[model samples]
Target: MIKQKRRYFSFLFVLPLLVVFLLAGCQLQDQFNAAMSRLAATQSVAGPTLEATKAATSEATVIATAAQTATAVANSTLVLWVPPQFDPNGETLTGKLFNQRLQQFEASFPEYTVEVRLKSENGRGGLLDSLSNASLAAPATLPSLVLLQYRDLESASLKGLIVPLDEDTLNVIGQNWLPYAGQLSEIQHNLFGVPFAGDALALVYRPAQTPYPPSTWQELSTQNLPILFPAADPDTLVVINIYQTAGGSLTDENGEPHLDTDPLLKTFSYFSNGAQSGAFPIWDTQLADFSSSWSLYQQQSSGYAIVWASQYLQGQLPGNELTSLPEINGQKITYAQGWLWAIPQGSSQSLEGARHLLDYLSEPEFVDQIDQLAGYLPVYQSGLDAQTNPDLKATLSELMNSAQPLPAGSTINSISPIMESSTLQIIKQQIDYIQAANAAANQFK
Candidate 1:
């Protein structure tokens, strides 16, 4: 394994000397980009394995083209675009923390100025849209770096809106981020982004009512406790999480998107049982998103609810406590997605400065602060250590460790409706779980 991993490195490297040496002339550009494939292989060396970049493109090449502007420009301004939740001027503690970090970046590298801009998370003038616009209309206006959702990163990379990261960054990320995080930072076999903040599904419950969160469906039924979750979410994320936890595989023998009927039956049967026990109310069908379900749980102080780690952590909602998802048997499971920092595909003049800022933001201290203050799961193992509280730290470690990257949109689209329909039917007592599971599986077959 070690021998195979060494193939990612073209040669041993030293940072300061390499940057200066590479910048000396255009003649060394080819040598500077000795191995573009290493840009993504860092994850493989770190562990669970990953694919190498298929194209012969690397940040060195990108930076090489604009090396003169980057070094000779004297004072350079690096622009960063973020969503409203990350607005530096906002009152949120996480926002304030970011503002402080940006200030620190400028102080550390006085030769560079970091400019902040706000963009919506989606839709008109959003990060993706604005990236597309700026890349076409005014290449110079493109922000040096942008924050993207894992799914959006896939889109941005596919459309050539974002560029691959350098090998050094991926090496650190592979060693720092949790396994799922490495997966999140990677898309289409390439390292295109660095995970800054991440989120995962977890259980939120009223501590006064239940001393310990139940770890199995049988316990919930035996205790006659109902857990509130959005059975109506179009994505069927809750069901998927539960299904996978019950030892089901989301892919078939063919390595394609699939539904395992036995596990589906087991999960749906829980819903059917819950409906009779009043663990799930008729109104659950009306809840289509986390907000509505979370609000309902708060109003009723209901037994349990499935919620995003961020929603429970960031909102600081009263009267509830967070824990890992209800484990099925001995295993706990959840799906995760997160924000990433990506360089927009444009002039590389700001690349050097942007990388500096990216490095600073990815520091363990900074990541720890965000995990505690911003309601995000720590992306790094060290960041997890920053939790401070032993109990919360232990719980988060287990849940985050259990997390897997949320599947692609196409996979979600294929399986969600079937899961949602079967789940709702069981909750509404419309059909036997066995029949429903069989019917759903037949569609995929």
Candidate 2:
């Protein structure tokens, strides 16, 4: 009886300890559950970061690599790189047409398989950047042909990334291409690209705002009305155009950028008159590029807007009418820029194919339809006549004849800053026309 009582007391003592251990275990489990819940909530709240983007890109690369399989390489493959605006597989009508054209080219030429890649129009990973990088590190992967702006064409030629066209290629190009178009690709008298799509400045105005648009700088300055342009553009296209309109030469015989005080004074005299007269308002000076001025004009829609023919046409906004630039000394003139087809230095074996493609693209029928749809001008004389609208045809023809190619990239790069500073000083009335002229000219010396 005594032993049984002792054993029962021992069981009661152990039962209390077991209950304490069970309570501690429950508390620890609850804490762990709370921590796990908090962790999930934090994860949900956090959005994708730069690190996530890089991780995703890496995963995609891994997947792509894993998917690759050994296969027989095609013979006579040609690779082409173009800006996004010219993407062949995009949803726009222009893209559809371009894609169809590529397919057509491939169908007609069975031996050649064309590969198209889209690149940004400017900046890092753009045409020039990729071209430069590939030229140094991945030469074998260099494109057979590339579409580049005239400025880039010059830079590419200077870098020796793009090769100059032979005499035979130049001769063929000269036969059909417009003079200014040919000039777009001419670097140091060597043809580095084949010009295809042309863009030029045009005057846009609302008929309701003004009965007749100003037809000359004389009229434009004296009218004392608002006119919008990128006066502060880093490119200093305004300065270049006005100086050229005053019969100034942008380059000397040696192909170096040159400036003369006479033309500079004449150009600034107009800015002086306009700024003082309010024809070119102080608010207009705030515009740093064509886009800002164009956007401002859209909201107000009361005055004249000077923009690229491409920008205006692509906009297709109602009530605004497009017209030729004003007459300067009985001549209709403006600055023109273009896109060109260029063969890379590594693409020697594909020269024949590249030239063939260039010739095919420059055909009047194709150029007419494509340029018209894409708000671009054809670089061929024949393409000019192909426009169905007689008035547009006439206007484009005049522009084609009178418009000059923008100054070479190197020339503009060297001269723009000096001229821009002086032009701003003149517009702001911080200096006289003579002072501005002298200031601009002295920089070149």
Candidate 3:
């Protein structure tokens, strides 16, 4: 009986040790399986990875994943807001081309969906006012991207809405964009926005009619023909351009308003004296419609007209016979500046995504399409150089190289209204005075 009890106690102690060993073995197996599963996953994507492949993939996967994430994040649906200048449905050349390009952007980057909204505001639809109001109620109501006219930069920028581009972004843009674009990006030594389009203005003339582009006010007056230029509110910018070309200063060295009497007198005297002598076509009083001038040029009713580059190229202006503004004492002067594409500060999307879209839009492939259909010169040098069509290429090259960019700093817009009103007043006075002077001369004769 005593021997049987000793054996039972010894068996009880051994059984507990055996159970502990079994539990430890199961735990080790579970840990091993988990590690093996991770290894298998890495091997599948990493191509049967050996020890050497592990280090390489650590770096490679990091880079690959980063690139994929960037593309994916930016490719998510993008929304763009355009002003009335672009009509997606109109038969206008700019309208047709912009739509096609929008399609192309979607096709090329399928990861991204682009939605373009055209908000047509009448003359009173102040972009700044509308955008400011929308942003307040629903901040997301503002589109991820906005198209701003070159003239509107101040009102837009001053509202603390535009984001400053960093060094990396500027580097990529510098590699791919035009000279003027990069230069304009820097505002007071800090870069703010990228230039998207140039609405350049030059003298549009019929080579057969004039035989020579007018170089001076004296030459233009001597032609004994009607000279035309845009002066209406839609194209009121022409007044500013003419003032600049005639040696009038829009802004002083320190960026102060400098639209003075001397410059106004010079500009008005040229037009008023010409009008009184019947040198200007009295019938062509309005410059609101480019077609009017185009009709005149095409019908040989006028020798020369000043027009926007886009109008001149797209047949909106009559004379296919075109040339740049003639030199004033051997110096070329033209008015040029247009809308720029930008993502406003505090927009819905991340800054990097906004920048990526900007980079894509400014790409050579996209810009060439815009240039081809719209007849606007490509702001990208690479795109312009890559232009294959002989006629289109030749025309754009001549304009881009010779064209002058308009100065569109903040001070310029603030004083434009004043300048416009003052200039017109001066012109009216000069015309009345010149008419009286001419009548007196006739009486004496």
Which has the greatest TM-score?
Answer: 2
Report residue 16 deviation for candidate 1 (angstroms): 70
lDDT of 1 at 120: 93
Q: lDDT tens string, model 3, 294-328?
A: 56666665567766777776654444455666545
lDDT against the true structure, per candidate, is: 0.80, 0.79, 0.61
RMSD of 1: 22.3
**Alpha-carbon TM-score of each model against the true structure:** 0.78, 0.79, 0.67
Candidate with more favorable, higher lDDT: 1 or 2: 1
* lDDT by residue for model 1 (205-312), tens: 877888786778767754666677898999989888878888887778876888887888888888877888888777788789988787777777457777888888
How many angstroms is residue 424 displaced in model 3 relative to the true structure, after the best TM-score fit?
A: 4.5
Error of 3 at 199 (Å): 2.1
Give the lDDT of residue 228 in candidate 3.
68
For residue 106, model 3's alpha carbon misses the true position, in angstroms, by 5.4
Higher-TM-score candidate of 1 and 2: 2
Per-residue C-alpha lDDT of model 2 across residues 313-395, encoded as one tens digit per residue: 78778777778777767766689888888889875346677777666765666766777788897888777767787867887
Sequence-dependent TM-score of model 2: 0.79
